[model samples]
Target: MDCHNYITVFPERKRGQHLGREERGAIQQLNKQGYSLRAIAREINCSPSTIMYELRRGTPLRKSHRGRTPEYSAKRGLAVYEMNRMKCKRPHYITHCSDFVKWVVAQVRAKKWSLDACVGHARLHQLFADKEMVCTKTLYNEMAAGNLPLSLFELPEILKRKQNKKGTRKHKRLKGRSIDERPDIVDLRTEFGHWEADTVIGRKKGREAAVLTLIERVTNNYLAIRIPGKNSESVMAAMKELHAEYGERFSSVFKTITTDNGSEFEEFSKIEAWGSSVYYAHPYSSWERPVNERHNGFLRQYIPKGVSIEKYTYEDILHFADELNSRPRKRLAYQTPEELFDAFLDKLYIA
Candidate 1:
């Protein structure tokens, strides 16, 4: 047999693999056993230069009978390695965008803006430099990691929701025209003046006050009118007031109104006499009017469930509706509902 065939061969270490404590301990033991740097590198599966650098890092001078002797220690090597690791990490993005972070926190707490809304509005209007702002995903990640000052509970919409399976149910009654007869253009939200109507009640007991909400399909212009109670009479009274306010343009502005089978809108179909069409969603089917339902959920933030609506003044309710209308919706390309709605009205009146 050839002697060269009996020699042992060690594979080179892979790139980016760092030395562990066991490797450091092995190096210390090998050095003490009078092993050469190349022999230790072969044993540890690393480069000989790696061992030299580790020795320089782990070795310390000791005062002894021989005066100032250098000793290599695995413990010291690990300490230096950990310290460098702490220093080598990239700095957080928050450190560079303190002002933007402050503004975002303020908007969330004061204006109740969503994280995506803040990021979108800022980017659309060039409110901050590119480097000074982080993306919406990064903001959410930072919030999850507790780096942001805001809590997850404050953003109820962002939390994971459990989806209940939808089941088919027979309707006992439908008050007006079925949504089945509604035009496809209304569902597509391509036409202006189409609206979804609903009533938000407080304290389900007794005849307490309530709010009548109407949201336009195209512009998302939300209107909230306080009513004496959740009854057909009260709803019609509010409608009459709206007709008086809009006058001849009421029919053009409210071309269609879709609502649920709530008792408050039992006579809602009567509004069709005023030149607008009325349709009723299937019983137990709120999803058919999703936009109005979402806006009602947004309203719940200000007027919580089981709270008496009577406590809020008409002006206060109007203010809440204004806040919702003025918010920049991502679907609207960051333009506010009021802005788009006013532009549409201008064109209608101009014609």
Candidate 2:
């Protein structure tokens, strides 16, 4: 063949290819001109199913005319095709597991379990077959797709707070034993009695009731003691009451308590007389006592910010802690905080 006479022919569309915008527009135009689905497919050199899907997608959501049947618009077809294309990806395998979806929604709504806890607990207990449930990330993706009952906003706590851009020097008074001097065993988390303490304040103003929280480092066990106020007096009184209740076991139950330099916990070091060690985190270093800070943030889900803590009863505060303690933690090998805490107590009592 002479180079001058050579003709390079490109098929309108290759076999097993997706329909392009031009092809979709053409199908819509031909269909409006009264072309059959098969005729449109042949004219565009595509499959009948492609033409069928295009027309079906391009059809208006509502009725178009009073008497005449709605016709496909090329513009609408192209737009729809593009939108669908933007969403094009591998069909998530998790979406097909309706049973798993039901379980996830129930766990979140009734049990108030976090997404990771739900998946981790299910896998740990072998509650469902491997094919039935999805991993944590897949479960979240399903929620994002609106396949489950959860929305991003309905989640108890998900996003992290952004730090302020302005830098300022913070002066936090370390009134108790410094965390730097604490035993290495506490940081190792191999022992059970090590606790991180903090306060949860509502509305962040006035002399409102607050919750005194303690989290066991080993098992993520949580305790919330509602106090009349967040003063040194109230904080010390709560610890004394707990000490009286637990008696001799109080020392073993609370081996060491780590806390920030909040005014309320300034007197925490006074509890050192109970044979319990009290340590304070460095100034403005909330991360130094992460367990206490994170669990306190979780408490906000129930008592919420900008709301008065005075409204909730003492029992309500305990209930919130109980709910969290009963839930499984991924780091705990799916064991609940309550279960692990009780087991540790039993061991201590036996010892």
Candidate 3:
């Protein structure tokens, strides 16, 4: 509709009429010379931009005549209208359009290909080549409506790649109380001091016993710690130091702690003097305390499990925590978790 925005190239000709051979010859000659597009356009009495586009496309002779020209515009419109009218009278046989559906399904089955990916590929590479065609989303709607035999939910099977097996400590042996006892406010995250905790294991082959770990919840932000041991005393001592160093930060934001039933957290009451509540996760659902699990994974880069943390200084752990906090998180819309945690604090009623 916006003719001014686009440089209309060739005027529409009668449907069967091709470009004159002489016109094609001229394009071929000028292309061989490598004359400036503007100079060629002036020689041919056409727009320079048109010449440039044609050259970029290797100067193929134009054959199709579809859109408006001063003479045939009305005829083309009427022809399109008649075709659509006839098409509307026919019963839909969308299942016959298996090629299109197969293409969509193939893309969905590919690795890491989301709906967004499918939509983008269809628009950029398929539909937009003919500007009049429906968009990818429109195609999806029609496909869904048709209820073709293809299952949209089933993605193609990727080769099964083995991942490092995460170790699970026996929760039954963990000394901490069950998560059910945690206050309701902690669940809502409306108040601070409720934290989820976990540990990230080291590399494959059980190389080290170093623990990169932390305790944090909605209201409180915590720096990571490398504990020398996985015992209850080591965990309790690290938490005690965290509370002591960040007394105000802890008092305000640190209200409750939730952790998987790891025996490392057996001494749950070590920081009870800090007035923070604590609870334990159920069996096999450590994702319930996502923050701790997330931070634990991060610590794997530094003080991984099975490694000796005894060799690393407190400063080393502190710096690692700094880097971890600085790293961007997708959950925070590319904002660093450190920034999100701080912003969350400013919004909370700190004690």
The top-ranked prediction according to lDDT is 1
Candidate 3 has what TM-score?
Answer: 0.46
Give me the runs in candidate 1 sitting further than 4 Å from their true place: 1-17, 29-72, 151-154, 159-162
* lDDT (tens digit, per residue) of candidate 3 on 147-195: 6344443422122244554555454554566776777776675554567
Please, what is the whole-model Cα lDDT of each candidate in the order they appear? 0.89, 0.84, 0.57
What's the ranking of the predictions by lDDT, best on top? Answer: 1, 2, 3
Regions of model 2 farther than 4 Å from truth:
1-89, 161-170
Q: Model 3 off-target regions past 4 Å?
A: 1-174, 201-209, 219-222, 302-311, 343-351
TM-score of each: 0.83, 0.73, 0.46
Q: Which TM-score value belongs to model 1?
A: 0.83
**TM-score order of candidates, best first?**
1, 2, 3
Whole-model lDDT, model 1 = 0.89
The sequence of per-residue lDDT tens digits that candidate 1 reaches over residues 1-351 is: 569656476455564589987789999999999999999998888889999999988998565778556879999999998999999997788779999999999988877788888999999999999999999999998998899999886786777475663654545588878999999999888889999999998898998899999999888899999999999999999999999998899999999999988999988999888999999888887888889988998888789899999999889899999988978889998888899999999998998
Give the distance in Å from residue 23's predicted Cα in candidate 3 to where it truly belongs: 28
Clashes of 3: 12
